[model samples]
Target chain A: MPDEAPNDPKPSAEDSPAKGPGNPAREQEPAAQAASEPEARAAEVIERERRGPSGEPVRSVTFAERKRMNRRELLKLVPLIAVGAVAIPAFRQPILNQGLRFSDWTAGALFGRHRLAQTYSDREVAPFEKFPYNFYDVADPGVDLEKWTLTVSGLVQRPGDYKMDQIQAFPKVVQNTRHVCVEGWDVIGNFGGTRASDFLRWIGADPSARFLEVTCVDGYYESIDMATVLHPQTLFCYEMYGKPLDRGHGAPLRLQMPTKLGYKQAKYLDSIKVTNVLLSDMRGYWEDQGYSWYGGL
Target chain B: MAATVAVVKQKPEETTTVVYEHPLVVRIAHWLNAVALLVMIGSGLRIFLAFPSFGPRIPQQNFFVLPPRPLTIGGWLGGALQWHFTFMWIFVGSGLLYVVYQIVTGHWRQVLFLPRDVKGLWPMARHYFLFSPKPVVDAAYNPLQKLAYTSTIFFGVVSTLTGIVMYKPAQFWWLAWPMGGYHFARSWHFFAMLGFVAFIPGHLLMVAIHGWNNFYSMITGWKREPEYLE
Candidate 1:
């Protein structure tokens, strides 16, 4: 194929390194330096006609060079083989974690923060009988219901423990959305709770706080991005299927964020610590092991 | 007269031709896609191991057995997802760019299979399987090649669309609904990767049979040819 650049004057100039004044190969051609466009065109045509169909210069490869190439090709496989030898076991998590912050930044840029998770009608919600035991790390420790309080701390003016009634007093928003697990199972359910954005606003949370550090009763801790924390679908959920969350479910409280994978929706009522800086050492129980921290969709 | 004689003497004796089999963009996209597919398959296998069975956990073995645990990328589900979501963009970007390049350069004519190619497919298949007689090949690709390439492109499109469905099923319910809901989309995504796994060995074998020169063309965008009789 003819070079596309030859027709486009700008690209022909940009592409040819020899066009530069400092090019050593052209330094001897003082007369050629002053050569006009027609001369250059003629030279280009001559060079083009001399080349083969693919624009590659026809050349002779000696037997010795071809012999050496076999070894060279074998040598090329060395790094890939080395990576295969020790990629996952030795540095799986570390290598996966590398450039994760950048990945998150790119995802944020591409997907944007304001986009909402898809919602379904109440009828589309899957029946509980079909697929049970969907979530992992289920913990329902005995607790005094009256004495239980949902604590809100860190980067908030109203940073104090509030009773279940106090939490319930806030206006409720009901959503029928699919809960997608990282393990590749999903179910639609009717989740009722205060919108997370509203809750963040109600708590007088600092707008500048970048993350929400959530701790569960089972010692399961996870940090969610502020964008997700303030997502319209993200909820401090307490009701499932139009009833108060049962013991098997996260009673009194659980995060019902459809945008995230199942693991990110931490069950069990616990303290929420909002902060500007992310946890440097630990991100989450699963995230520390190598999971993408964002877990969006 | 002396300079002309010297130039003639300096020229090599062997008359050879080099065909530009691939453009620079195609070459770059080809390798980018290879790396992207490798990373995706590795991490996707890890993701699959998180829940090996479809319905519920059953100990009984089926026809398809997964590679050993260590061979798999499933040490950590989170880590696997990390690798999967990250490299997914690279796969999407490179694949789309390749399609765009083909369309823009009118290279799709050489790749996309037409009804007329069906007549040629049987002969190509017979040549490969029966070892009857080698059929005349095209300068770029054969009919069988066009069919395979076109199907693989379809596979890639489905894989990416299924990925989106899995990623945000709730957000992209319209996409998931046509695929028979979330679970179906997941299965489709898994199977598409399997299609890639199946396609790769056959692709490599063909390249091997075509010789190292064929493989080298992808890297350097040039193919070696003997001098033709005018």
Candidate 2:
């Protein structure tokens, strides 16, 4: 280890040479030892040189002679790094851009459903058909539309919130999909709702929104990168199973973000906001508190 | 002058090597390091099984006991979380104390981060693989070993930070900002697991190459003759 930095300022990392015992004498010991290393190495090198006819020639390679790495290696890293650099910046644009990620991720989630998944065996319009998802007993979807307004705020141009009915009018598109939870559960359901992207686009959100933070009426919330939101597997749906969607599920409106874990799917839509910067690690009400926010398998 | 003249005619003293390395606490800490690494890896696999798919879709096999989410290990997920965090503190606490102990006791000098070591990596690597001429007899650790140990410490702290971010994100979420976010923290946590997995095998190989005589010294607190150590 001492051989690593031959010129480090620390003194010789070994036994101290004997000196007359005194306060000042010991005070100068480190300085005295510090002065001895190069001299000692030189003495050792000189002694070795005197003994052996050939020692490893000082340094066979000089720094100037070194060449840059080969083109192939550099080429391989370019695309990967470039993608990350580009995508990461997308998350830091501005507040108006905030909900864009949610739009994109939800849009991607919607795109994943091949016509709203396979319909349930009981296509008889069971309102609470999507009931008992996983084990969490929270999130009673008995949502009231009068109080249901998505608060679109944070780092945005026009941060005024929109009501669920207002969002529903923005070019509704329903697709069937299999809701796959990371807990190894998959449910086939049909969800009809306004395209979150269409709604975001209608709102004319900032193009640079890189992160999407969503808060649900029931206090459920999640966040995701813009690219992930737009990955064609995300969805924004108001109808589930077959019928006019009961409030038991995330009725009125809920997101089915497929690429990520189910936790990102905030039920009972409360708000959408554009953000240029991603949430600080300290953000995320649930995830920040260390429940799996990614919610994906 | 008289003392120098008197010593000039003196006979060479017989050298009998003595070992002075770890005290009992430090020794306990070291063995804990070895043990904890193995347990972390074992439990880490159980956690990874939940994902089932990862970078490159690499197929994985479960080894030993398979459990789930380190936090809630047994009631639903049981003992794994307790074991993981419990030993995690032991591993980390001991490592921290050992470092402070080393600093206060001045063992840091013996292992000062060296420029020679930074420069010696390739040569030390080459020497380790026998690609170069015999390795220089390092007094403590070779440059490469120093680098590896330093990186291990760095990763150890990172592992702890990421673990905290994963565990109590509300309290330690600040740690995740430098990395990326929650997902990024999770990625870092997983990668740290992989790093430990990779490092352990390589570590054992080095130990084997260096011989068990030195390896056992970690337990016995006494090594075989350390050549040229005087």
Candidate 3:
């Protein structure tokens, strides 16, 4: 605010001429009383009439010429009609969708590969009971934990149903990170899982794939950019608070990414596909319904 | 500012003077930014309705009476998010253009409130609220007008910065630190909106009091026989 202080008082003082109808002397000037005006005041009026607001020469014109000038100035604002298109019901949704897509693209571009989400100490983690259960459908989708296997397909060298033990075989990672919801709520909790990058490497997935699409037993689906999918903090989560994930928290396996919104951290993940293209009609569960797909924090 | 006072000859006996009060860039940015700000406020309220609190979600304390539905834009949370995300670009873009233009043209001097203007504020406020004698002002804007206009710039900066932190918290984690982290930034964003909400009614009322000629100046950049000239 201090930097905004003006340099000098000279400009304001020079502009403060008392030459308006409010001044009795100026009011009497047009009534053939020019001889009665003060010499200094008459000189000031002549100087003011010669200059424009920005010190340009002022141009005298006819009434018709002034009207034409106003019309030309008004016409230049016609381009703003594009914004008014949003008021039409038919155009609203599409326009908004495009905007969201643009935002998602920018979010993807800003995503840092090595940048890490802030990790909390054990004491900073919210209690297990404090973590709210959020799901689009039923919390318990009734996945048979013992018989469950991750079905991997699409652009992976190894494409088949893989057992839980096989995924758990990768070096386990335990960290406490914040989970942010699109609703503006957030919580920090302890999560244990293997690095998603490690699992992708193990499955020989194409590193250049543009997207990682996942489907959940609860019917929730999500598509993540390859950059976020391969981030170091991204995890194939299997446990919470030192215990295996419960039914309410996407039992067996879920995606736990500190960098993504809760909706993107899909729970009860049934299948994950490494793909270069996403289905046009179904990008994500909440996303298809109008929520931002990028859902990055 | 000195009146431009271009004489428009109507007849041999009579003439009128017009002043170019606003530049074309300023006029365009003003109207567009006005629309963008309205959309931002309406959709922002709807988005806030989803959580409606600044506290921990576990305890779930409600902040205030929920904003009535009619006052908000977009029918639901998802719908509101779309509108909010979309118009934010327009809001930021126009606001930035206005500021950069003001600075580049040295026109900010007309509106930016400075320490010297502080003494004149009480007199302007007294004139408006207490019906005191109008204080003579030399510049394009009086002290109180400058205060109100200048505050919006502050609000714009706060809202946009806090919004960026919330939008990409992880990517801009360092940005959140100065605001006491993400939670405080959200609160700051809300407060900034409150500032806008407070400003608009007074702005509209003043425009109404000034009548059509003053209002038309914003649209056409010229005021026919401006009050000061008259």
Candidate 4:
């Protein structure tokens, strides 16, 4: 087999470093070298050949030697077999979980502390009717609207139940922002609420708490990272399109973070806890099942 | 392109020659990427099935027929996401390794399709499709083969870029600007998958038609009596 350099202008066997002076083959192939050529010139020719246009060695090896070389090359690829471990039932979940966790960690790291989610103008907001009511269990979890008070606990200085008016006491913020679902659908809707940071400060919640865990009127629960909890756009939403929350939309108070997936925005807020630790088995409703915990963006 | 040819003599009149083809790095990256692509495509289809449309949630309009269950991987949406997320790193890693290696080694000239290759494409296509006279074999890859391989890099770039936007739309929102927005990026990501779907069958068919020695070369980095060499 000739070592052909298709586009290469000069092809010569002398370029091969494998043909060293000590090699018997070099002595046997001495016919190519001119007797009149000085040793220094001949050495330069060999050096230039060794560094050929592509710096690729041009050589010939016996059939048996080729087989050995092929075997060695094939061996180099054996590490790729480790990727097949995902096929095993026991290993699959753990490996995938690690991958998801890594992705979540990256997402969390990429999340800007003060950066706000993209806000849209009023005209760009999706029609109220167009916003689909997505829920895991029921769209309208029956909550006594008048009696409903967000039960605050954990690391907050104020650990008592608070009425909707108390949450509404903070200066109101209204903005249109896109809400993305884990299923890949998205809608820009008008949301009215107080900044979660302001509300956290009012509630005397510890500013440095690592996570804010929340439960819903329904069985669904979620834990949010403190960085997101303090984001200006993270809202304890009480109104949508300037109307008080409807039963279908988590009524009294629900998390309305523009930066988080719809699932992380727990609706029909029941209790809130500021804590550093999350129950291993109970991260979030969908997250425990498989969804990424850092449902950022 | 650091290829070596070796000849072995079995008898006085019998001699066989073998040529190194794929480098070890290329072989490793190729197989790793092959596995990653299979997982990515399979799991991606399952993820797409959750919504199956680019339209709004209300008055939803599905784009096409749902992919058959057998064709998809992972049992459910969440499970499919796990597979997709897991293999994404591998896909990107292998692609980067292959590309960086090609560039650093200056081996890209062997397979990268350039403007100069445009003229040879018709002749090669005619040879393959119309059963015309075989074009003279010279390089490891012909113009059409170069085009096919080169297009994959384009598809890979599109897929990875769109994937990043979809994965971190808020953080990488600027990336979506060129493609229009997050919604359009999703569509582009799906289309990129379609590009691979279109390429796979033809790629496999060509490999099958080329026989075992050709396929073995990818694994062993050597081809026995490659026709181009003859």
Task: Compare the candidates by TM-score and give the number of the best one.
Answer: 3
Q: In what order do the candidates fall by DockQ, top score first?
A: 4, 3, 1, 2
User: Model 4, residue A233: displacement in angstroms?
Assistant: 0.5
Q: What TM-score fits each model?
A: 0.77, 0.43, 0.89, 0.88
lDDT (10s digit) by residue, model 3, range B42-151: 99999999999997898999987888889999889999999999999999999999999999988898899999999999999999999999998756789999999999
Runs of candidate 3 with Cα error greater than 4 angstroms are: A1-59, B1-14
lDDT of 4 by residue, A42-159 (tens): 2212222332123333233334455666788878888888888998999988899999998899889889988878888888899998887876254577899989999999998889
How much of the true A–B contact set does each candidate keep? Answer: 0.27, 0.01, 0.47, 0.46
Model 4: fnat (fraction of native contacts): 0.46
Query: Tens-digit lDDT track for model 2 on A1-297?
Result: 112122232343233222212244533443454476543232111111111011111111111111111122224334323212312545323321332334333334443323222223445332343344542365575677667677787655667867767766756555544454433234445567766666666676765687778777777667866655554445677766546556666766777754444556777777776677655563355555434443432
Off by over 4 Å in 1: A1-95, A110-114, A129-131, A134-138, B1-15, B54-64, B67-71, B226-230
lDDT of 3 by residue, A1-297 (tens): 001111112343244343332444533343333346432222212222223334322223335555766788889888988999999999999999999989988888888899999999999999999998875255678999999999999999999999999999999999999999889999999999989999999999999999999999988889998889999999999999999999889989999999999889998989999999988767998888888988997
Per-residue lDDT of candidate 4, residues B1-230 (tens digit)? 22222233343222234556678888888998999999999999899899999877777889768988898998899999998988899999999999999999879988899999999999999999999998974565789988999988889999999999988887788899999877899889988989988889989999998877778889987666655433
Clash pairs, model 3 backbone = none
Q: Candidate 2, which segments miss by more than 4 Å at Cα?
A: A1-297, B1-16, B53-79
lDDT of 1 by residue, B31-150 (tens): 768887888888787778777755433232322677566755545666667777666776888799899999997778778988989999999999988997978763346788888888
Winning candidate number (DockQ): 4
